[model samples]
Target: MASPLEEKTVARLVAAATAAPSMHNAQPWRFRFLTGERVVLLHADLERAMPRSDPDNRALHIGCGAALFNLRVASVHAGLAPRTRLVPEPEDPLLLAAVHLAGPAERAPDPDLARLYPAIRQRHTSRHPFADKDVPEDVRATLREAAAREGAELLFPGPWHADTVLELVRDAESRDVMDPAANEDLVRWTRLGPEADTAVDGVPEYAFGPRKRDGKAPVRDFTGRRPVADRGSTSFERTAHLALLSTPGDGPADWLRAGQALERVLLEATLADLATSLTSHALEDRDLRLLARDPGSGTGQVQMVLRLGYGPRGPATPRRPVADVLDVV
Candidate 1:
């Protein structure tokens, strides 16, 4: 077999990697390619970290982990076996992962990874209200499997559990309102008016969807007492379809795994024609996070709360240029 990786192939992989979601669209990741070794390195861009909101840098690591997952998928799609190592260097905390591009005698993509290639670009976070409808059990099973592949659990909470989780989100929202440090992060990461039109990062005004006029979805109100012209109000779904992504341990490694699982489940949901939005707000706090977990099972740390249904898929947000995030050697 010939060389499995070239500059162009690596560039394509990096593009897909850059598309992964970050907390508040911070997009905190950097990539380096060692052509001699055919290894791609993932690093955390500390400059993009939300110091106030993500004090522990858990969200930052999750974002980088998501990017690493995309690289794996993209590599497979390009007929190369991707061998990934998370936190390969304990001495270098910023180095999140290293992926080797292997050229085997038979060069072919993993069927499952290749299957998700199309959904990578199709999946977007939909902040708008979803139509009140039930997601089929088969689809739920697919999502669960996706999470399982990345060593995480996807749980569709019961009605009582969902209510409790929503309450925790509300409590979190109140905390944000009261905490100036929290507001600082939102204000830093949200773009309004003309700023949203040209910004390369941060949540744009158009992507925020309509202000919640009614209903209880754990969607964060990014505006947060700020005013935006033409931002109208709309009623969200009454019974929001909520799924929690969790891992047995809560640490940098687990956060990375959670992020990979998150993107996998998201791609699966998109393929199932389900619109999705994420809520890490509730799980930001330690006490609130515990309250958000499964009362019955009482295991694992909830990484993200995803609300999925049929709705308008969110508009594509901007990302830093490929050259900005990648360095090829």
Candidate 2:
């Protein structure tokens, strides 16, 4: 028989899982611990889904997958091997993943996952400007290896390709301005004024970073052109260090794999003392996604565009309480 997992241990793992980044900091995931089975079920909270921005729920699934990855890491760090089964029940669509914590005999943690534990909290989506310095070739290789380990590809685009991706972001930003529905998510998930200080979920105004007075970093302007109190405007990096993450196919499973790869790369970047941010806005549109892919290597579907550099890390955003997102069953 499996040993009974402690409530405190389960809570710690859930807290670490919640720290994973989400689109607009929505943090759209819930956890249910099956004490008898030594398993935890990860479910997507559809209520947090962005109907306008992420209509097909791809981003939602990616966010939940990220949380699931974190849980595995936390479990390993706590001296338990996490044997995860993705989409364990297709009939129950909300159930995105189920992780079985290995019992006493099989509880040796994976050193790889355990080493990344400290970076879970350190990783943040830095929307601010980054320096013009290029990421060293060695670091680039390390990041690529990290993604490959999780069954995804990470490409540091060459100048010409990077410019093409940048243009796609510009086009997406322009479209966002004219499309009324597109702004719905930004409004719903952004916290302003005093709400920024107290709200437990959503991107606070302070975390919005500075407005793009100039330059092209592809950071989304969450203020929706309404002007934020005490917000400043500054020029971003003219040549933002951008990396594209892709998978062999475009399906729910591929998206989950991409998410795990995404977190792995982010944690490695954080450990390397690099600041990072994500921009899925450009990939929101189907046409834009097609354009965002590498012209030379047109094989995989692009899932996320990451901005990396040396700069001040972002402030810790709020997350829902563990009780709010977990249940003991």
Best by lDDT: 2
Residues 224-257, candidate 1, lDDT per residue (tens digit)?
Answer: 8889889899999999899999999999999999
Best by TM-score: 2
How far is 28's C-alpha from truth in model 1 (Å)?
Answer: 0.4
Measured with C-alpha atoms, the lDDT of residue 253 in candidate 2 is: 77
Q: RMSD of each candidate?
A: 1.3, 1.0
Model 2: per-residue Cα lDDT at residue 295: 91
Range of the 10 consecutive residues with the lowest summed lDDT in candidate 2? 101-110
TM per prediction: 0.97, 0.98
Per-residue lDDT tens digits for candidate 2, residues 1-329, read: 76799998999999999999899999989999999999999998999999898988889888888898899899988888899998889899899899999954776678999999999999888888898888999999999999999899999999999999998988888998888878998899999998999999999998988888998788988888677877888988988899999999888778888889999999999999999999998899988899888899787999999999999788889999999999988
TM-score of 1: 0.97
Give me the runs in candidate 2 sitting further than 4 Å from their true place.
none
